[model samples]
Target: MEQQPTADPRGAIETVFRIESPRIIAGVTRIVRDVGIAEELAQDALVAALEQWPRDGVPDNPGAWLMATAKHRAIDLVRRRERYARKLEEVGRDLSLSTPHHVDEPADPDAIDDDLLRLVFTACHPVLSAEARIALTLRLLGGLTTPEIARAYLAPEPTIAQRIVRAKRTLATRGVAFEVPYGPEREARLGSVLEVIYLIFNEGYAATAGDDLLRPALCEDALRLARVLAELMPKESEVHGLVALLELQSSRAAARTGPSGEPVLLKDQNRSRWNRLLIRRGFAALARANAVSTGVPGPYALQAAIAACHAQAYAYEDTDWHQIATLYGLLVTRSPSPVIELNRAVAVSMADGPEPALAIVDTLATEPALRDYHLLPSVRGDLLARLGRTAEARAEFERAALLARNARERALLEERAVGLDRPAAEGPAGTAAVRCGRAGPRSGGQ
Candidate 1:
């Protein structure tokens, strides 16, 4: 009698792929010295697993099984090439002569981590454009299919496919190294890595140009990467800070949308819906960040401090806006970005009143960067409404609606705009407008 496969081996395969694709790709890249080829070999392993795992029982260590299978595929690929002799010599010397073989033993844990770190640095290399780095990193590390990434970012499927293909080719053509940098080089590359992760988290927290209000999967992916990076580089304070900011912000995910998937302002959200566990994690990460810092806070740490203020408040009214404003002031002095100033203005409004914040918003009205920023007008509109200038507030709200890219956000702005014309009981004037800076004219789901 023949042996039977598991009841849902196909499902099991997909689950394993999502969990272990990064490791497989990382390990194979160490073998083949090419990310594109490594990914191809990893996929081949998946195909083999799909064909064989159902017939044979799933392996106890499926990740290790995938890695071994990818290694074999890589070896076959090398042998099939016309330059097999030269390539084998190169691999023999580069990999310390430990040639791969069909064995059930797991690869060295330290080597796996090294490979993963190399893949991370390679995917986020400054040689590639920021957009390319993000798309490729998500595909390689997030284990997201081309279609899945496209759907998440509201991009056409073919565009994302081309982006990933071009990114890999660019890396190969440029002969980018497959290893982490040290000292100055490491610090420089670190910024790009952090930016990539930040972009991912922001896109998930607030969809840039999608009909959906939020994409929790992207947020989860970014958070997982941040946690991994924090573990990989424990001495890096900004990494922990980024993790803290993400955790604190993500705790509000449950309360960020309504039944119809409409945007829910932070003040209007039900505090009970916030995730307590995430809040606790955010606090721990914030503490770790502070512990690792050298007295001066970094960009991520300052932002995390701002988020912490909100997380610590049990109610909207209980929020310590004064402290938040102080933190944002420090952030402004350090980062000196118009966006930071805009956010600080919001904090000022909460701590002081609409008058002072409105003055600050007016100063930024002519700022080239904030000219198209929807949040600027949104904040201005809220201040105008509070100051009894209903007509001006209506105009600002309409302008914000015109600038908003996300359908949900546009609808929210429109709602706020139209409500001003209604009676006091039906108007949104009592509540401040939600200051949203993450969404705008930028493409690819912001």
Candidate 2:
């Protein structure tokens, strides 16, 4: 007789950990009613899989295995407490108590698909402040470790630790539900939820830590989640706007880096490498955002509109800076931010001239928010260079270079300042200045 074949051990192990992470967290949250505890239990399931899968051979249905493992752990814990025992009953009829949701095969994809979304809405629920929600959601749904989350946020590990702990405690004490919102509350929370997701995606698109310039995995994961949200919430215009934004932004990944992983400025980047399909999708989404409006566009829609402005141009010179300046003006009114104003200054420079842009920037020098913002000096340098003020420009560039966290960004800024030290006849500033100036718009992920 032929020997029976075992399931692909590594394949099953990876799939179980990857695809099931979100759903398992969601399912666990329903039972525990505490996202932090649910996440810990989910890790317990992950640990079990890592220990068993390689030895027992991969299960034919790995997601079910992980879910089963988490549920069994829950049952064991709840058996010791009456209150927690009631929790098991609350999660759909004590099947969690007797038998977990796992079976010999995968569950219906459609049925379990909503788990991730539910987890997102719950973790992003308005009960938590913005910082708390983002920290907790990235922990539970993004599958990132607390340390990783800390590194991404540029916050100390202890600070991130405290925030997550406080967030979980708040949720439990307040008895926040682990389900989607309803009625007016649903619409109210949707925008913040979407904003959190987009922020995660952007962090991954351009990493702020380590030696890596891009963390493509995080970006793709975020993009996948956004696409899912767009499909699930098709009626929400901002949902599509976010999806469109991610799709279009990600399309440039291939060309955003040079031969050695150095950053590539937009003007110098090969436009041919950009994905036309994504651009089209982005345009359509902007149109949708417009259609849903009785008045001004939401933040995401306005940002998408701004991104669309860049996408419509075939070349950098062909871009409509005047219209971009106009969009930034509206963006400021809807969402007043120094960062947005900094972005607007770039468009203002291109449309009017360096003088007006410099004046506008000078007005923002005292802004508390822009005090540590490297782009402020970076923008000032570009405008100064445009007006034959190289000495001042060099100082601004050097200041920007010191404040920049990204290695590639700092290198480019230093290079520009060095270049300005040499004498040359004044004309238009180099393509590099224009390119580096664009960094002001994107570097802060504003």
Candidate 3:
């Protein structure tokens, strides 16, 4: 083993691991026929790399190196198992023969993509719970470790680990094929796939419980997956819609946090810091979504349009609230989520007045879904503040701060509650941008 001269080879090892883990896992799963075992082999390769890279100085083509290494491990493991003959027959002779020479038989682009798409569909299989689907997809398709997935979503590590374990067991027990579904089956599973990716991006955009406001790495992972899905299904308007939504929302990454890493509300963020490149990409994606659409806009397309409304507004006051409200109205018909209604209420507040919006929020106050959701009270507090009901607004803000999980958001909510000394509704207009009660359309990058 050649020793690496670099001071920090471990960092390079980690970077390589994150980038190539998904591909390695996908490729190995084809041979192993078990996602869990495939992942173990991939991790084994990473461990080998960590041990050797610092001595061998990272390989010229690290990804290919890792794949070759993982394939060899898979072959060895199967040979040791009692069902070696059955496994060899399943993977066929080509894989077995290539393993001996370490010839690095990286498949063609189309085949590789097919493997990845299969992995995505398998991880997002409807047989798994929604939480399980998200966890498994993040683990298998996003190259995220169980602990990393747990941290990103603010769930307990053991809980996430169990979810991943159970999800893989479920797929195996149900005899879920490691191939993309076709026809109606494909369409049926597509929603869950898109949803898992969306949930990942939302967590990155607005962390649920972390000290930090945003996790850029998670955002990058989600965006990359969305773009891949778009290429894989060019005719799918909703795929394009999802890409558009993520692009538009990500455009504000720079402006979303203050110098001290405090949460910068959309209404208060500096427009100049918004990434123009991402915004343009978002517009192009939205155009593609529209061009491909046959009838009503999909859920993601509608949400993208709403985000576009915010992106195009050079100033918060210039935003077309009425158009947004109309879009929300349309979205409600299509999605009909309480979270959507909360978002619509925000638009209604901006378009009409806080009175009607307050009515809507009051109705949602008792909603089971919104009970532990801090944003519900946060939005209600903002509305109350605007309505000159300082005492009620203060209480709501305090309650919101108590329920909020993220440190930055909790601090912001506490600050708002403490600042109730001023006469109600005396701040600049648009001070309280309508935040969705939960993660849904019209959220500020969430």
CA RMSD per model (angstroms): 7.4, 6.2, 5.3
| Top candidate, metric lDDT | 3
lDDT of 3 by residue, 1-446 (tens): 43345656888777777767777888898887789889999989888878877765776567777787888888788888867788778777345354322344455555566677788888877788888988898777666667667655546889999999999899888978888777778788888889877866776677666577776766776787789889878899999999999999889888888899987776777999999999999999999999999999998998899889988999887888898889889988898767778888888888888889999989998887677667778888888888888799889899988887778888888988887785543322223333332253235322
Predicted structure 1: lDDT: 0.74
| Candidate numbers sorted by TM-score from highest down | 3, 2, 1
Error of 1 at 430 (Å): 10
Ranking by lDDT: 3, 1, 2
Model 2 has an lDDT value of 0.69
Q: Could you tell me which 10 consecutive residues in candidate 2 have the lowest summed lDDT?
A: 432-441
Q: What would the per-residue lDDT of candidate 2 be over residues 1-446, giving only the tens digit for each residue?
A: 22234555666565457546767777777666677777788889887777766566565566777887787777667666656656655765523332332256554455454566677778777778877888887777666667767655546779888888988888888888877767677777776678667766755566544455666765765666677776656678778777777777776778778998877776767889888887887677777767766667776777777777777778878878888889888978887777677777777877888799889889989986566556678888878998889899989999988876667767877887898867742322322322112121152121
lDDT of each: 0.74, 0.69, 0.77
Supply candidate 1's per-residue lDDT for 152: 46
Task: Please give, for residues 91-150, the per-residue lDDT of candidate 1 as tens digits.
Answer: 563232332223456667667666766787888888888768877976887666776566
Per-model TM values vs. the true structure? 0.69, 0.74, 0.76
Task: Give candidate 2's root-mean-square deviation (CA, Å).
Answer: 6.2
- lDDT-best of 1 and 3: 3
Q: Could you say which candidate leads in TM-score? A: 3
